[model samples]
Target: MNTITANQLKTRGVSIIQDNLLKDQELVITVRGKEKFVVMDMKHYNYLRECELDAALHQAKADYQSENYITETVDAHIKRIKQ
Candidate 1:
């Protein structure tokens, strides 16, 4: 992983990120000697979000196949959750 200090970012700005991202898919931003934030290209970020959704969908399908869910009326569902 590539890392950049907050001071470097404050002094150099987005161009440093742009240049680093050409070599790495992501960059870690550190603040006050602690890892604080991550920076990535929007396309990469969207791709990762899609992957997360896909994993969730796969888990839901597996749960359904295993009969791990319930079927109930909306009122019953709300009442059960309220309890």
Candidate 2:
């Protein structure tokens, strides 16, 4: 992990962001010798978000498949409900 002081990061924010953005690196920003923040490339951030969404979708699908209330077809299920 790469670490940078809060002052250095604040003064050279653009360069730090540029370095990480271009190289897909993670920057750990520290304040008062303690880690405070992290910076990551947009691509990595987007991919992480997508992975989270996929995991959530997968879990939702698993839940739906295991639940007896879910049906294969909405129309057929509605007709059964009406009958």
Local distance difference test, per candidate?
Answer: 0.97, 0.81
- Error at 51, model 1, angstroms: 0.8
Per-residue lDDT of candidate 1, residues 1-83 (tens digit): 89999999999999999989999999999999999999999999999999999999999999999999999999999999999
Per-residue lDDT for 4-58 in model 2, tens only? 7889877887797667556546778889999998888778789989999999999
Candidate 2 ranges with C-alpha deviation above 4 Å:
20-24, 68-83
TM-score of 2: 0.67
For every model shown, what is its TM-score relative to the native structure? 0.89, 0.67
Which residue pairs show collisions in model 2? Answer: none
Q: lDDT score, residue 73, model 1?
A: 100
Q: Tell me, what's the RMSD of every candidate?
A: 1.5, 7.2
Candidate 1 achieves a global lDDT of: 0.97
Whole-model lDDT for model 2 versus the true structure? 0.81
